[model samples]
Target: MDSDKDSRFIPVNDTCNMLEMTLSFPEQLEEAYQIAEKQELIKINHIPSSIATIGMGGSGICGNIVATSAIENIKMPVFSFRDYTVPEYIDDKCLVFAISYSGNTIETLTSLKALLDRSLRNIIIISSGGILEQVSQKFNLPHIKIPAGRPPRASLGYLLIPIIVSLGKLGLFNRYEDTIKEVIKEVEALRTDVNADIPVENNIAKDVAIQIKGKLPIVYGTGEAMGVVAERWAGQFQENAKVLTFNRTFPELCHNQAIGWEDASGITDKCVVISLEGEWEKGAKVEQRGALLDIVKGKGIPVLHINITGDGGLPAIIRAIYLGDFISIYLSALNNVDPCSIGGINSVKERIAPYIDKLNLLS
Candidate 1:
């Protein structure tokens, strides 16, 4: 029962059906935007000298997304913090966005408290009601409550849109609405193009799924927005497809990771390189990648170069992301696994639950 021949690879299976969640991205995105747009954002008079986002796992990605776009949108420094310790750059002049889908991520929660201990006056909590939200309510911090049902990873749109909208409030970017609509259109188009209804031979996502079946995915992207998408792709593959991935960004990889690809350990046979390239790629970046691409190809490696084009801006990033999502689901089917269930993650959570705390002091 080869999936390519039968075309069952795209069909939803038991244990998890992520298709509906994928389709609901537009709605989730709109909801997130409305939440941010309506909120009476605090500290409107004083813009932070720097911005630090605190979270781990799926929720943490929101910060990374903000950081990626913030660097390009604002002159101020912005970055995400994943550890229990808050970065030293965060002070009263810093804005901290604490994100946690479940609202109870120990690391993010700890990081939030650490920031508060520093007397950081500006902090916002985005969550679906966990310890994070509870503490936010108690501490009188600005909080955005998002709809919850799907896993944190599947809540990308719901989580990410607010950040974009908030940036709009800060005058960092003025194109949230248009960019969101464009992203919705592009994702819908991507859905139609890569859905199970489309035959494998004609589907780009399916083709990549087939090629990378049972092999490790090595995702490469440039330093800009595309790099963030590549990280999301790797995480989706890990959580949805139940596969491991290696990641590298261009320019940086050329210095060390490029030469490491030299077939000393048969990596060429077991891995597929998925390069995420943006249309706005500059000549210097393109030239640097050319040499790296040559080295990988010279070793007889398979490469999937995805060229993201159009004026969609943020939407272009989502389009590429949606493609990778479809590929993850298809890969799950090919692997005969449930795209919806993350048993390994659950097991670890249960293992750590014994030491989980009440955080009564926060309340």
Candidate 2:
């Protein structure tokens, strides 16, 4: 372990402060649940045949988790759009949700405008307050105002709960009340394991982060929760740790990616495999995970096994996400990088602004 702390890393004091704020996710989730219950009372007049959630970056990732998790359960198709345009197919039969934590995200705002222009049915907006909230009010669209003043990634609970509660309101899901309670408990439990005060030796998240340092992370998950958590981990690695990471769902990976592993002999040494496990109905998932781990290990790649611990689906999922978030932060510290800054992203946006302006003018 590198004992000398790097000065370039987000200051240890800052990381501690952020960790304390991150620990509030459980309480925030509880508050969101309460607000969602009240919001659920609002009538949804038009129950669209399908659902589409529009957002970008962290906000879009939350929608991805929700849409992916609800795939099997939701009777209507649920799709998430991370781009600037709403799908042309979205119309009166679609429930379009424009979710932007900052409410200023360019892509989400663009998609929201497209949806509004088409007069999409059952349009709802979730934002902290910006142009999105203003437009929602002007159009008389159903809007949920979440508490502001946190990073978009940190506000996952706020961004996600409203969508789930709205689904429950629309009669799409019935067990949300029970699920919310379970998820809260799970997040509270996870704090003991991932909290900043916990020494590195005692912290599972820290241990995993240390193991993956200097190596590309490849996260694999089996069931719905696992898949969603894997994707979250990948995003955390990208935004928090500024590390390259990839994710893929199981059973699907078995079809093609599994075969490509043989040709990856050299690069395999530079990669770490993380397997995410959860309570899945399909008993064969465990077998598949075991086989994949064995295959990768045989190829000389290091492997990390993380078991999702919690009672219900929502809690288990939240626990996994919490673990990933903590691990990514620790990895940021290990890499000697500021976890809160995204210079590359800012530069990319700056360089693209001129083209965007020209495109807007052309449109």
Candidate 3:
């Protein structure tokens, strides 16, 4: 049942429609797979020794996942670039995915220009359409087009799956559709549990929102496993809930950030700590996170932990990410903010129109 149809506390979501998109993540993944299958990518006879993806914000997340996943799965070099220029190590021999949810992102365009100037032709574009599409047509480069309209963050499947399929096409990834199907199942299950229509008592996300209300959220996760997911949670909290959020991973925080918490005269009460749970090294009984929990609780601060429910695969990662997304949305409703509105970003773009408004992303 769509929350929009229910009159009980979801009227705000009815107007925004983000709740629908959030709940439809499984369908989005299916749509991405279908679209990727239909895409006609240019043939690359030899798989490049390295891969890099350039993007920012929502589009950049695809690259982050690729870079992180590649570290564990791929022997070759892979990187996700958020800046205007590619690293010196990336040359014509390296394959690049120029991703921008709105194809007009000036940074990505500028980076693409730099690549072209370097005569680097091994690049593919993933976007809905804008200056990127123009560049794609002008250069006759292959491009993948996804649906536009909703927020870029909500279109995770559109931005992510093409990259996955392209890698499979290049023989870099072995399980393409199967991996996607598994995640879709997990997300489907997650949606039912976290839906806005679900009551607060049974909904973990709703429970989280209630607990962290009127407090800053500081999320900590295992560095290698959930760093990107932590960042995702922070970004969602910032954009959807219109709140300041912080994210850090383990060990590194143990050495420095934990000490700062010792003298929490003014900071401890204002913040709620959420430690995203994941597997730790074998025989490491007292994980740094376990120690940090005692440290925070000793200061009389609130600390909570959440873990993924599925097998530790892409499904687990996506499940955790989806949970955070709902928490942010539910928190948005709690704070009376519109989840779909991005006034800060829009104001900046509007204010800088003369210098940065050359391309129409919707076109």
RMSD of each: 2.5, 3.6, 3.1
lDDT of candidate 2 at residue 7, scale 0 to 100 = 23
lDDT for predicted candidate 2 compared with the true structure: 0.77
TM-score of 3: 0.92
Question: What's the TM-score of each model vs. the native?
Answer: 0.92, 0.87, 0.92
> Each model's C-alpha lDDT?
0.78, 0.77, 0.81
Residues 198-284, candidate 2: write the lDDT tens digits: 766677987898899999999998776688889989988987788999999887887787777867867977999998876553567
Q: Candidate 3's residue-wise lDDT over 1-363, tens digit each?
A: 344423233426435598788888889999998888888887776778899999999889888787766754455787899987776788977889999988877778778887887888888999998879888888788899999887898998899989988887777866766777887888889998878778777789988987887999999877555778888999998988888999997767888987988898988779999888865423342377788889998998898878655444566777888999988888887887788888899887677556444533223
Best-to-worst order by lDDT is 3, 1, 2
Question: On a 0 to 1 TM-score scale, where does candidate 1 land against the true structure?
Answer: 0.92
Q: Which prediction has the highest lDDT against the true structure?
A: 3
Please identify which of the two predictions, 1 or 2, would achieve the higher TM-score against the true structure. Answer: 1
Q: Alpha-carbon error at 38 in model 3, in Å?
A: 1.0
For model 2, give the RMSD to the true fold.
Answer: 3.6
Please give the range of 10 consecutive residues that has the lowest summed lDDT in model 3: 2-11
Off-target runs (Cα >4 Å) in candidate 2 are: 1-16, 37-43, 71-73, 310-312, 352-363
